[model samples]
Target: MGIVRLIDRQGNRHELQALEGWRVMEILRDWGMFVPPRCGGSGQCGMCHVKVAEDWSGKVLPPGELEAKVLPLLPGRGETSRLSCQILWSETLDGLTVALP
Candidate 1:
């Protein structure tokens, strides 16, 4: 188990219990957060966008090929933008922080 910190659009912070092997999108969705159903965790749709905290950007691996292509076209993409569906939760990701765009 691990903790993942999430910041809503309104800047409210939330701490979630993250299970290993689950996708970040799944964690958010299961916690009642608004994750779009576009690609349904397939990493094809960019709707599950998140801006990784600058300090945490290097912690998570780079986006996959499909996520790489889609992220660039997203509206609020930042230098640390990522597709949540492409991120698999794990012990190493404990304390990871991301903000919804």
Candidate 2:
């Protein structure tokens, strides 16, 4: 298991235990966080947008072609924007931090 620190829209911080091999969106949703992954984990919807902490951005894999295309269309996206549904969690991501937009 790894730790994912999530910052909600309200600016509240939540430390969640992440299971390896799970999508970040799944971990957030399972913890009762508000990531409306309308397209499930397919990267078709930009609803699960999150801004990864700058320092941690390089730690995760880059978005795939489909995700890259969709990310730019999302509102409030930034340089480190990513779809939680497209991010696969792993032990190497322990302590990864992201903020909900």
Please provide TM-scores, in order, for all candidate models, with all chains considered together. Answer: 0.96, 0.96
List, in order, the clash count of every candidate structure: 0, 0
lDDT (C-alpha) at residue 66 in model 1: 85
| Residue-wise C-alpha lDDT for candidate 1, range 1-101, written one tens digit per residue | 99989999999999999999999999999998884658798988787899999999999999878888898899988999999998998999999999999
Worst 10 residues of 1 by lDDT: 32-41
lDDT of 2 by residue, 1-101 (tens): 88999999999999999999999999899999984677877999888899999999999999999999998899998999999998899989999999999
For candidate 1, what's the RMSD?
0.8
All models: lDDT? 0.91, 0.92
State model 1's lDDT.
0.91
Compute the lDDT of residue 87 as modeled in candidate 2. Answer: 89
Candidate 2 whole-model C-alpha lDDT, 0 to 1: 0.92
TM-score for candidate 1: 0.96
